[model samples]
Target: MKAIHIDRFVSNVTDLKPSTIPNPFSKSSQDIHIKITHAAVTHVDLLYAQGLHQNNRRHVQPPFILGTEYAGVVTHSPPSSSFPPGTRVFGGGLGAYAEQICVSEPTIRRVPSQWTNAEACAVGASGAVSYGALISVAQLKAGETVVVLGASGGLGVVAVQIAKAVGARVIAVVGGKEKAEVVRGVGADEVVDYRQEGWEARVKALGNGGEGVDVVYDGIGAVESGIRCLRYRGRLVVVGFAARGGKMENLKVNKILLKGVAVFGYRFGEDSRRDPQRTKDVWDGFMNLVEDGKIRPVIYKEDYWGLEAVSRALEDVRERKAWGRAVIRVCEVEEDTTEQKARL
Candidate 1:
């Protein structure tokens, strides 16, 4: 199997590339063998490559494969498995940037029939976290207003879409006009350019009765500003610190206290690890949204082809050049001829 092999953590993405490794296969009844067709490129991948991600560094040393989420076709599975051979599946696990992966059945889910491999892979971990934050953790409801920080980025874009899917009016906070347009195209009712002064005020004005929003989905660690944009008793879900270069924010509790808002720290992967059934339930809800045509993966416009483009994909994401989720198309979709022709 060919994979983005990391022999050691390096500061530069150029040091990373694909290398041939032993193919992973189903070793037990619990395992499923998959032929990966596409995978997501994420900031966490870059962080892991640079040895900057604390949790990954603590558990996984060098000489491992890169990537966390992938969409692939099942080639082998035990008879007891729900995902039999030929099932189209997408999920998160280590070592996704490879031609093949072997994971336990519990970690994967069937890809919606309407989604292509590229689309499924593009949603991957970002979609999961976004859904978990907005629906599960924040308890966002229809008719409420929510502000999505860093709304043009991978995770933020998904958050914006999910908020809208649940009938919430979306105020997307981006850094530029182009990104504002990008989020608007994805169903955001309002767009606030964070580069502009008083952007938080602008976001607040878009809320109900020009007061404040019902929820603030914070992926950028703009703690004080996010609190400012929230209504009294609003919910704030912290998903990441992307805009601050992955640094944890020192939040002032005065605003949280004075505003009477609820602050929830959303760690989707950790929560999933702690309660697998909850993760399954989240996926079930996400799938319902997918089936209803209320949500879709927003793939970055650039096409990254094959394992050779892995380095380039990593570089693009690191430079903040991708508007949505950047994905590596590992291979052409190998659906049955009838379905392929129908899709064409």
Candidate 2:
């Protein structure tokens, strides 16, 4: 099977190569064999390719497939599982950029019939994290005011919609006017461009003259910008540090203490492992939201550049040039013979 492997860490995007390695699942347990239809490229994938996230213990070495989200149909599974063959599903956790993947059953979720493959692929990891963060971690309540920083990126878009669905008034912060518009379209009650002068003041002005928001979901650790916008006793959930070179160095403890606010570091993977049932519940709720049309996943672009474009996709995400989620169509799946499948 074809796959994109990071043979070495390099500053340039062209360093990645597409190679034809043996299909990964051929030697694994026959209980799972997923034909990868759509694999979404994330900023994390880019950091892994450049070896930046390696130092932070986020990624392992090269010669590894570099993706974490995907949507595809099941081509094979053990008969003991409830999911039958040819099930349309979306699963994400580890590597997903190859033509085929072998995943544990717990990692997969059945896609709603109403959702297209593109929509499912776009929602893959981001939707799950958004659900866990807004609904579970923050415990956001109806009629409360919330601020979503980095409100135009993949996870940001999902977070905005999920917050709105939970009945919160959303204040979105983006990098530019175009992104602000995107945030607004996704149901953010107000939009602010962080690049503009006095953007925090504008955010303050929106919250009834000088009052601040009840909750702040900050994906971008833009230091003082996030701290300045929060109301006293407000909860700030740190989902990621996308804006500050994927690092949070400038945050001041004094500001947090002075505000008497509660801050929580949200790592979805850890949360999922600790509370698997809760994670499954969140995924089910998200699927219901999709079925009811309360939320929609925004997919900016789809590229089937075979395996060769993986590096370019990673760079696009890292540069923030690709808006929303950028997905790569990996391979198509066909039905296996009933007799052959039964043996598994």
Candidate 3:
């Protein structure tokens, strides 16, 4: 089977190459085999390729596949498994940039018939992360005000829409005019260009009575600014550190203490691993929003057509040329359009 193999970490994503690696091996009987048809390109993929991601620094060595999330068809399953062979599913796992993957049955979810391969693949863990941060962890409420950092990225777009879907006013903070436009199209009530000076003041002014926002979803590691944007007893959920180049940021505990705010570090993968059932509930509820057209995975417009384009796709994300989720069509398949048009 063909895959983007990382035999050893390199300094540049361009140095990675495709290899005909052996078929994936299943670790247990509960693991089902999938034939990957589409996969999403993410900043994590870029970091992982260059050995800059935390997993790389701590434990994950090379001689592994490069991608993290995918949509595919089940080719083999254990007896009486709910996901029988031929079921269409989308999920996250290592080695997703390959022709095939083997993951635990509990980890996969059935793809909605109305969803396109691109959208399904693009979803990856963004929905789960947004759901966990906004709904589960932060307990964001309707009629509240929330500020979403990195609002144009895949996960941030989902967070913006989820906040709107729950009847919250969203102040989306992005780096430029293009990203600001992207967030607005997804239902942001207000867009703040962080590249502009005084953006923090602007966000605070838009919040309740010019006090501060009810919640801050900080996926970009702008911890200090996020705390400043929060209202009294506001919730700040730290999702990622993409803007910090994957490096964790130091927070001012005095700011948090003075504001009487609650700070949370949300790791969707770790949370899911620790509490699988609760994670499934969150994911299932999030999918209900997608099925009802309340939320959709925001996919980048450019078409990356094959596995060979994986490097180019990563570069596109790294360059911020593809604002939303960038996906690669590993293998083409006819999509069902019977229910409704795909929310691309």
Query: Highest TM-score: which candidate?
Result: 1
Candidate 2 local Cα displacement, residue 130, angstroms = 1.3
Q: List clashing residue pairs in candidate 1.
A: none
Ordered by lDDT, highest first, the candidates read 3, 1, 2
Off by over 4 Å in 3: 57-59, 334-344
lDDT tens string, model 2, 184-264? 788989888878899887886676447788788888766467667877887888888787785657666899899888887
TM-score preference between candidates 2 and 3, better one? 3
TM-score of 3: 0.94
- Largest lDDT belongs to which candidate? 3
* lDDT for residue 49 in candidate 1, whole number 0-100: 82
On residues 1-344, what C-alpha lDDT tens digit does candidate 3 reach at each position?
Answer: 99998988878776666789899998997889998889999878888888887778665678789899999888899997899887788988788889899999877888877786578888778888898899999999999999999899989999999999989999999988888888989999999999889999999999999999999999889989998899889999988888887567777689989999999988887787798887888898798888889877788898888798898888888888888799998976545333322332
lDDT of 2 at 102: 81
Residue range with the least summed lDDT across 10 consecutive positions in model 2: 335-344
TM-score of 2: 0.90
Candidate 1 worst ten-residue window by lDDT: 335-344
Candidate 1 wrongly placed segments (more than 4 Å):
333-336, 340-344
Off by over 4 Å in 2: 26-30, 54-59, 302-304, 332-344
Q: Order of all candidates by TM-score, from best down to worst?
A: 1, 3, 2
